[model samples]
Structure formats: C-alpha cells, structure tokens
Target chain A: MSRVSSKMALAVKCSDTFNADACMHCGVCTAVCPMGIEMLPRKLFRYVQIGLEDKVKENISTIYSCLLCGMCAENCPAEVNIADNVRFLRKYINENEFNLS
Target chain B: MPLPTKDILGILADNLNQRKSVLPISSAAATRWAKGLDLPKGGKTVLYTGHLYQLIPIIDAMSGQMAKFEDSALTKYFGLGRNVNKFINMTFFMGMMASKDEQKDYDRMLRNIALLLKKADVDFGYLYGEELYSGALVYDEGVDGSFAKHAQRVADMFKKNGVEKIITVDPHTTHTLRTVFPEFVKGFDIEVKSYLEVLAESGIEPTNQITDDLSLHDSCVYARHENVVEQPRALLAKTGAKVNEPRLCGKNTHCCGGPLESLFPSESHRIAGNRVEQLKEAGGSIATMCPICLVSLRKAAKGSVKVNDLSDTLAKAYGV
Candidate 1:
C-alpha cells in the first residue's frame, strides 16, 4: 500500500493554499472534531500525503461530513489549513467522480 | 452504505444555479420579514441578512424531510428530484413543510437585530427583496463553480445598489461576504460587519437590567473565521447578564454541526446533541449568534435548555 502512484502524487500536489505535507501526524484535529470523526485532518491528510488514493476513497463520506468549523485548524500544531485540505479533496471528488464543474 | 454525496450536492447545486437560492422560495416569503420595517432601499450602508435568518425554517423543514429519506429507498429519487427541480421547483413542497411558528421565531430574531440597530441610532438601510443568499452553503460544500457565479451575481447586485458597507446578521454571511467574496469576485470591496460588532461599537447601554444567566455558544465562523468572538460576548455583557462559558468556547468553540444538516442529517443531529450536553452544563438559558446554531442547538436542547438567539437577549436588555 506504500507503493506511490505518480497519478495519486500528482493529485495531492501541494498548493499555496493547501499543504497536507505541513501536517506532522498530529492527533489534535481528531480530538477536536465536534462529531469525534477520527479520520479527519490527521489521518485523511496523512493518507493524501502518502498517495493512498484508495484509503481516501473509502473515507469520502467522512470528508463530506465535516462541519468545516475550523476547530481542527485552530488546534493544529503544524498550522495546516485542515479545512481547506478537506475542501480540496471534495473538489477533487466532485470533478473526478461526480464530473461536476 | 455510503451516502449519495453526488446526488445530494447535485440537487443543491442545481437549485442554486437555477433559483439563486439553495432552496427555491418566493421573493414575498424571502422578504416578508422586512414588511412594515420601512427600511430605505439601496444605500451606502445596508443591513444584509443574506437571507440566512429568513431561510432557516425552510432549511429545517427541508432537512427534516430529507432526514426521513436518508436510509430509505426514497434516497434513489434524489437524482430524479434534481432533474425535475431544473424545471419545477420541488423545494416549494419542502417550503410548505416549514412551521409558521418557527418562521415567526427566526424572523423575530432578525427584527430584534434591526430594532437594536435602531435603538443604537445606527444609520443603515435594507436591501429588502433584492438581497441575495451569500452562497455560503455551496462555498462550504466546495461547489466552487456554482458558488463563484452566484457570488459574482451577489457582488454585482451590491455594486448596483451602491452598498459600500453591510451589517450582516450572521457569521456565515459575514465571513462569506467579507472574506470569501474578495477571492471569487474581482474588486469586491464591501465592508462587512456582523450586527454584534456594529452594536458593540455603537455602545448602546442596556436599559432594562438583565438578571438571566446565559450560556453563550460561539459560532465557529464568528469565533475563528471572522474574529467575531469578542463582539458577541461584549454585546451580551452590556445586558448586565452573567454569561457562562462552556468548556469549549471562544476561539476554541465547538461546532453545532449545522453545516452537515443538508447531507448528513443523522450525524448532524448526533453532533448537535453532543454540543448541547456541554452547553447544558453551563447552567442557564443558551444563546446563539447564528440562525443555523439557534436551530441546530434548539432541536438538541428540546426545550430543556431554553436556547435563544443572542439578539433576543440583547433586545430585552436594550428595551428594543
């Protein structure tokens, strides 16, 4: 599962606004979620960073279910834009899976 | 089973693209709250509701209906509903499900906000029916293309109305208009302030002594996104009320899960229930600054905690 796909690598490229690479596997985001969703800004971003597209796919609902309330971003030690990363993933899904503009 | 995210978001995106509101509502129903308020139309500064308070009851009714359909076979029809919605507005049926009393309660909050502004002698006008929804839902949901077009429309409407400054009633509207709009709409330069911020600046002294103990639920959008944490607290303090802080509050505030209401109703309710427990421990009537927070927390509170719009508390204190 650690085998990286150049395709997946391309998909998760760091942008000026979105940098999951800045995450340091901190569990603060998971602890702070109002829903107590565990695969949030921490595990999800870790998945993205490792090019685990299948893992990201399995948790698509978890991504959409986020309140985007900024709690995770506030508590993050690495100062990652956790909410924006979730949104970037959503946009990726919308464009790829749903074919939405 | 996974949720049909594509279908649900498709319906919302279609509605926004076609109807200009996430839910299709008549302009009369949208602007009915401002009736008899005699607000001057089109001014340099305006009270921009963003139709957030006005649309809450419909959102509640629509989401309540959708919640019933969540795990059922009827979920298949969401795609069909989206197709039909392109021509015929299915949300009208949903809008009819909204409780009149709930509508009145939310509308009363907006009225109280306006009255408080009046009491402060703040010079402002209203856009009335011309006001648009801030596209906060689509933006948050990452329906960027639809949101961008809708944002441009809202910005153009503001420019047409000569609105240099706007006093937004809720945090979602404030954050969207103030922060997100600039990115989507070129030259979007509207000065956006939440009513609480405006009131805090106005410094209207409380007339009636408020002795009620209040637990304040800070909106995540206000607290973290827009830096509006202190403004609401400051306004509440002016009422001579003792405001209790929940364990998770201020910049570290917990979400009410209102944002998930559209797609994940059951999970949304579960999260709201959890936040209500923490808020209830604060020991008093609960106050919320956002309509989404008011509705989400009130449903979880179930009359046991007495959730209220913060404006209502301020209305009583300032004798508005």
Candidate 2:
C-alpha cells in the first residue's frame, strides 16, 4: 500500500481547494494535452479523491509527464484550474516519489 | 533518497563564497561582470543575476567529489554521479543534464546587456557575491518552509547591502523580487525593474543591421503575468527585425512547455515540439526573451530551426 502522506493528501486537496469541482469532467483537457498523455486531469483528481495512492503510483509517469502548460485550465469549460492540480501532483511526486535530489 | 537541497545550496555557498543559486556555468562571467568595475559609482542600478543564470564553476570543480556518489543509492535514483573513471564523459553528461548551454547563454546575455546599457548611459552595478538566489524556484517547487527561510535571507542581504533599486535579467526573478517578495517579507520595499523595461525607458538606438524575419516568443511571466508584451517587440522593431505573429500571440499566447520541464521533461518536450510547430508555421526563426524557453525550444527544434535568446538578436544589432 502506498503511504498516505500529506503530499498525496495536499495533491488531492488542491483539486477541491482550488475549486476543481467546477470541472465538468469533459475530455477537453485530455484532447488538448500536447503529449497525448492518457491519465489526464480529471482521472488524476479522482484517484486522489478516492485515496487511490497506489493508482497514483501506477501512473507515476503521467503524473511527472504533465507539462503544466495551463492550456487545459485556460480552455476548461467549467474554469477548473487543471494546471495547478498537476503542479500539486508534481510537488507530491517530487517530494515523495522521485529523484529531485 | 533525494539529495537534500541544503547540501546543494551549501556546496554552492562554499564554492561561490555566498549562497546565491545562480548556475555554475556563468560563475566566471558573473565574476567578470563586476571585475574592475567600480560599483556605487554607477547610476544606482544593482543588476540582480537570478537563479539558473551565472554558472557556479564550482559544480564542475566538484566533479571530483562526485566520486563518492559512484556507489551511492542517490546516484542510482538521479541516474548519475557514478562512473568516476570516465570523469570526462561524466562531466559532459552532467553538463547536458544540467543544461549548461543555457547557463552560458545568460553569461553571454549579461555581457551584451551590459554593452547595451552602457550605450544607454544607464550606470549599473552587479552585486557580485552579495546577491543571493531569490528562492524563486524553491517557492515554485512548493517547498514552502525553505522558500520562506530563503526569502528572508534574501531580504536581509538586500537590506544589509543597502540595495534600493535593482535591474533583474529574467521575468521569474523580476516577478519574485517585485511582486512575490513583498508578500513574503514584510517591509520588503525595493524597486525592481526588468532590464528590458529599463532598456525600453532608455530609448537606445541599435547599430547592427537585421533582415531576418524573427518570431518573438513572449514568456508567460513576462507578458501575461507582468504586462511586458510591448517592450520586447518595440526593441525588436528598433533593431529592424521583421516580426511575424504565431497563431497564439500576445496575451493569448500558448505555453512553450518550460515551466514543467524539470518535473516532467518528456512531456515538456512534447509541448515544446508543439510550440515549435506553431513558430515554424509562422514562417520565421524564433526569438525568445526567456532563458528557459530558449533552452526548451532549442532542444525540441533539434537544429531544424534556430531558436535564440532575444538578447542575442539585440546583441547582433547593438553589441559593442
């Protein structure tokens, strides 16, 4: 089981704290993602919400792969801040999972 | 295990004689920027070299120290600092990993800016060893405690050095010092100006002839965040660089995939690839104002197109 650290919690919290509920769960962010990354935004937040730490761990590539381009956030029909959520996930991953040493 | 940032900054402080987080690539150039040039005699401008610019030189010198990292677990994770016998190869690999070219660019960029500012008659003094990293990256990385601590240290240094007005070279530094510092450090009231803004005010004329159709990429921080959209275009126009517009130009401009490069490299490359396509489609070589953008786009272009710092474009036209 993946540890339930504050990094994971804060990463999840960013979605709600940043008002990600405004997200309509549309596939536009995934469509606009230049890299064609599959995990996308809403799927990631949902993993965090459900405390699916292992699920997040499984998609570590997608988590670190986020470009934080803000294009998705800019085009969000519901005006959710997808970029900030990805950033929060990056912080969590860097601190908890990766070699940002 | 990740290497502690304290160790990173500590080694930097030891090698550089201060804790500033400037890259090691420009260490020599940074020293030379102020060498034999009398400060306090200038037009009261303290040029602040932000993080990622000004190579430390010590990092290369400390390559020998990496020998300890050979068998270390940290090396396995970060994927280097092993193979000490081939120090030469390892060093080059480290340079590539660290984006040494970008460091060199800032050093060169500084010299060109110094030449231009001299032409503008704006006397400027670099703080040299006294200036510290504004901790901009630390904050951006969400290391809140370190950022707060480092920000205080930076503020203290400014006060200790009696710095009043500063000319910053990058938008991130300019944004942090001008906007973010006030929020973090109470009574942190100091005037911060980007060199571009200062140059814009100077109205200096360009001497080099430019005939290339250049497409300028405005940085998100520089344009949308700071409203510095016109100054660079005005400077490029003054230099006679024929400008072309990309599909996403001005405030509506698209990302260059830089901000996430460190955390998400391959994905950032994809974004850079897309941005390059947009710029190439604009029918001109790219001119970038931000250092990160220059590095990212240059990598993505793979010599297929030229991507250069706006300073180089200006340097060709106005360099002394």
Candidate 3:
C-alpha cells in the first residue's frame, strides 16, 4: 500500500515494448484466478499506457497474484505475454521501493 | 539416465556431519545401495519410491524434523536416538515406484500404518489426490490420468467417512479438492483448505522471537496454481522477522528445479543457485513452504545460504 516512486513509474512506462496494448479488457484472467481475487489486468494495461502509476499500485496485489501460467497469452488475440507484464509490474513496484529508500 | 547415487550420498554425508545429526536413508533403497549390509533383527524400516526417498529425508533433516524421528532410518544407520512408533512416508513416492504387482506390497505398508494408529486410538488418513477445480483443468491433460477417476474415489471416501471438510497439506491437493473435484463429482459438498491457511485462520501467534531475516520461497504448487502468496508472508510477519523479497518471486517464481534435479542435475543446480543468490542478495535465511522446493533448493545451495521449511522456522520460533 506504499506509494510508487519515480523508478517504478519509469519501468511501467518502459514496459510498453512488452505489448501492454494487446489486452482486450475481457475478464478471463480474473475468472480463472483460483484465489477469486479481481486483478483487472485490462485496466492495469490501460493505466500503464497512460502513465497512471497510482492506479497500477493501488491494484498491485492483483498483479502479484497472477499465476504467470501464460493462459492469457494463449487466449489473447494478439498473443500478448500478459504474465510477463505482471512480473514487470512487480519488479517495478520493488525497484520503486528500493529507490524511495 | 540413472541418478548419481554416490555423489548424492556424499553430499548427504557432508550435510549430516556439518549439522551433527544422523541422516536416515530409506531402508529399501539403502539396502539395495548397501547390498551386503546385514539387517539387524526387529529393526524398523521405511520404504519410499526413489524420488521421495531422496527428497524427504534431506529436507526434513535440514529443517530439524528428521531429528524428532530419532528411531528413523537415519538414526539406525548412525546408531543414535531411541526408536519411536512415528514414521514419515509419502503416498506419491509409493505410487511412482510400485510395480503393478508391488502395489499390494505398498498398500500393505500403508495398512500397517493405519493399524498402528488405530491401536493408539488415533485416526489416520493419507492426504493424496486433487483439491481444486483449476487443478483438474491442468492435470486432466497431464500424465497423471483423468481427474474423473480420482474425483469419484475421493468423493466416495468422503461420503462414506461422513466427513464435511478436508484440510490438505499440499496446495496442489487443496486447490483440486476445492475447485476441480466439484466439476466431476457434483454435489461433492466438502470444504477444502490448505493447512497453512487453516492455521492462519485460527489466529495462532508465534510464541518465540524470530529475529533472523527471512526470505520466502513460494512453492510453484501454491504460488502458481493456488495464489497462496501472502498467507505465509503474513505468518512470518507475525513472528516480527524481517522478510526479504527475491528478484523473481511469487507468481513468476522459478521452480526449485525439483522435477529436473535427478534427470538434469547441472540445469537444476543452475536454477537452484540462481534462486539462492536471490535469497542471499535479499540478506536473509530462505524459508519455503513446499517439501519439494525445500529439498531441491537445499541440495542446490552448496552451503552458500541457509534454507529452512516454513513449518520448521515457525516451530523453532514457537519453541515447539
């Protein structure tokens, strides 16, 4: 629940190369989540594209809870690697914390 | 390709000497390894499939659980500790190793355990089979066989026993029971939860101080499939110990290289070493939830860092 620092902001912005745009806003990822927690991956994708760091971190647990099963990639029309994006989000969060300190 | 049995034993020997604890090798395999060793009359022996036999003792020893079972195979070999009725064995191991004809032999061993427990007026049940719905989604296609077969068996057993809920130690089993089994075994009304989740729910507090820094090695079974990332962390946090985060942890977490260890030692070692380095950089003792991860990571460690199972860590902290 901590604030996202500038470093994390940079990472989130830089992760555009991983094709955050490919997400179709469907909720298959959330439906398959065994924890039954809502990740809103599509929303996170939109926020990241627009440099909305606070929105991303506010839903950080959703990102962290992802199983990284590559199921989303398999299902995606663009074949986007959504799991890797989630990992980058986590890395961004951690790197931001380190930088803030 | 066969496993490097001598090399594995040599490592085990070094660890036992360093920890100053007797390492119990499983009787069945050990006898095969030590072909000429004379069996002592009335000595108790434990039989495990090759994989589980190698894994369980090492992790248990590293976590200090092996010491509690003093009369175990390890103690018999080292000539230490009094024998107790309690023994640890895995059903998965038996299932993997037992030849079609030898399955009866395996069942007999399990039946013996049940008899021992019954004589003591203690009910015993082996927690084997699926727990979650998503587990069936993945496992139904794997080599393990159709989920329907195990689902029906579990349902019938639960109903016959008049059991309302089941707590599983392994997250994989917990998930399968909770989610997937409901798909095949309709009206299979039984609650499924992980042992750690249950303990956390009980509001148990750590009785002893754990001042050492700790890093969590999320089990692939738990983290990847079940999303049980925070429960263990919360438990560690309750102990007031500093929790370190690894570079690639939680969902993106790498396997402790368990499946690959015996088949591909060098690759497994590289992966384990990579994880160990992450833990070391985070500056804390690594704690893992899965037995497989504990064993694989410990073997992979090469003495560079300390690895402890979460239960063992909690036990030490609580002075249990």
Candidate 4:
C-alpha cells in the first residue's frame, strides 16, 4: 500500500485553479508563526501558483503546523490568502492519492 | 402557567445581545466578589457546582482554604494568581463584596447566571451567614427550608413557563442546571441544552458566503464540555465552503487562552496566537461557537484569519 493510503485523507479536494499570485515572498509569516516551523509564505504561494503540488506537499508538515491566525495575511503587501491556501493544501493532501517518494 | 414564548425569546435575545456587546467577566469573579463581602460568618455556603465555565473562578473562590486549591494549577490552566496573596485576596476572596452600584452589577450578573443556569437545570440558593457558618445544612433535604423553597419556586416558574427547551450558552450553567440542580429541585421539567445545539437544530444557514477555505476553533465550552464538535462543522459545511479540520479539534480542542485573559494577557495572546496558527495550518477563515471564544480568538487573531460566530455565519447564510 502507498504511504498516501497510510495517511488520513481529507474530505475536500483542492481546486486546480487555486492561485496565490498576491504573495510577496515576504518572511513575515515565518517570523510570526508560533510553532517556529520555518516556511516562506511567498515561496509556497509561488510553488502552488505554478502547479507544483509535489513541492507544496513536501513541506506539508510546516504548512500543517500553521495556526491560521492570519498575521501574515495582514502583514502581506500582496494580501495573499496564505492561511486559506494552507488549508486547501491540507485538504488536497488528505483527499488525493500522491506518491511521497 | 407557561410563560409566553415571545417574552422568553425576547429576554434570551436581549441577554445574548448584551453578552455579545459587553464582555462579562467569568462567574469566578462574581464568586470571589461575593466572598469578599464578608457575609456574616454564620452564613450557609450555597455551593454553585458546575463546569469550568465562568463558574471556575467561583469554585476556586469557595475552595480557597482547601489544601487541594492549587494556585499553580489555576495559573497553569487559567494563568491567574501569580502571587499567593493576589491569588487569595484579589482573584479569590476580594470579589465577594461590591459597593451598592457594584451590587447592582452583581445582581445583573447573578440574575443572568441564574437565568442561564435555570435553563440548564441548575438550582442556586442564596447563602445566609448562619447556615454557612454553622455547616448544619448537610446534603439532606429541608436542611435549609426557605432556601430550598425559593429554589423550588424558581424551578416551578420555569416549568410553568412552557420552557420545554432550556439551552444554556455557558457550559457552567449547563452542567450545574442539568446535573446538580436536579438533586435539589424535584419535578423540574426543563430540558437543559447548549446554545450551540439550538443553533445547529435551528437549521440556519451560514449567511456569509465564505468562498475562501476556513478552519474551526473548537472552544472548550462547545467542544469538550458540551460535545458540540459537529454542530459548527455542520453549519460550516452548510455554506458549501470547505473546512480544514485542525489537529487539535473537538474534545482535544485547545483553550483560546481565555482563562488566563486577566492574569497573563500577553501569554494568553501567545496561546491564542498558537491556536490561530493551528487554524491557519488547517488553512482558512476561523469559525467558533462560544462568544468568549470568538472574542478571545479575535484578539489574538490580529486579522490573520477571519473569526466569526456560528450564528453570525447563519445570519449571513440566511441573509437575515
């Protein structure tokens, strides 16, 4: 069985057109994140915008560790929905069959 | 004998609106204030037993002298009472007595608490100095005849009022009214339910069509105490909006750092921030049930995610 099946699947699927063009690649999200799990909100936004689902999934734990408070969204010059995208990614990860290796 | 439903609903709606606009301190503060009033030494101890909703501060106040009263536990759970004297004097005992105006405040607080508790099935008694001081009022019935009678009268009024459905918004009221009051008030026909349950049952849709994905903040009162885990989710699901479940959801839901609000505002902010991060990780706008939870989470939220109440959501969904 694939590790994808081993992990819990999300009930919702990520929309293919889920875009994060507004992200400014600022490190503010990483700074305010309570867990101290380093993740560049802009970089994740870039990868997701480009349809790099594998790259987004690679950093899934860091994304999952977000508290979803929206400090980064407030601070973002681009006003990217960082938290929403993170949730979308989580739902995608849980719902879709993806190869971890 | 039933009270008019419109009147009851009006009262409830007014109370809910008041609570929403003005943040009432936890019931624990009232208990402490009551203790500080220096009720004559002989007064009976009217135990208001319930969950750690607002009543926790009161419970802590009453059990102040007991060895089991651990300050650290309170600080750990609630983040109150850094100093021993402050814990005992300020947080616990000092709140017992307020001035005349303060007494009015106390009356309002107590009345609201009473109404909420009555709806939940909890009975309350006014403690007289003599009975409390003497400790003569054991667990036996009629130990305090007048006190018991007054409680019975209130319960009877509720039963006569056609209050077939009594929903408490606060968990402390729910636990006490549902679990403890039945022991004292015989033949009380009120069915204690939580406000979240009522909201869920009302079938009100989320008014705000949140196209953005969202997360659910499981409040301690709604999630752990009342087991209202699915109701909010069901409401969120109604919006046809995707919900991201947090790692620490449902009964395992974290405190929004509410208990520590007074004691360690900054640390509480950090805890709230931490929970917000979890919601963010789940990724989306945040929805909660409890008013306190909504307020606490919003303060910490700092606008990272959208925070709204289930009712507010339904109002948006229904365009009401």
TM-score of chain A of each: 0.88, 0.76, 0.70, 0.66
- What value does the lDDT take at residue A101 in candidate 4? 7
- TM-score ranking, best first: 1, 2, 3, 4
Quantify all predictions' global Cα lDDT against the true fold: 0.86, 0.65, 0.50, 0.47
After superposing candidate 3 on the true structure, give the runs of residues whose Cα lies further than 4 Å from its correct spot: A1-101, B1-141, B144-147, B261-266
lDDT of 3 at B135: 25
Cα lDDT for residue B224, candidate 4: 43
Tell me the spans in candidate 4 whose CA falls farther than 4 Å from its real position.
Answer: A1-101, B1-162, B170-172, B183-189, B202-212, B263-267
TM-score of chain B of 1: 0.98
DockQ of 3: 0.02
Interface C-alpha RMSD, model 2: 4.9
lDDT of 1 by residue, B1-320 (tens): 33478987888888899889887688887778877888888789899988889888989888777788888887777778778878988889877889999988888888999999999998899987788888998888888899999999999999998889999999999999999999889989889998899999988888998898988999999999999988877777767799999999999999998998888888888989999999989879899999999999999888888999998899999998
Clashing pairs in 1: none
Judge candidate 3 at residue B263 and give its lDDT. 25
DockQ winner between candidates 1 and 4: 1
lDDT of 4 by residue, A32-80 (tens): 5444556556676656555565676677545544544455655566766
Please, what are the lDDT tens digits per residue for candidate 4 over residues B115-234? 333333333343321111111111111112322443454455454444454545454355445654575587764677665565567554444576646687776544544566786677
Per-candidate TM-scores read 0.97, 0.74, 0.48, 0.40
lDDT of 3 by residue, A2-95 (tens): 3545655566556543466656777775554323456556767777766677787677545544544444554466666675576556545544
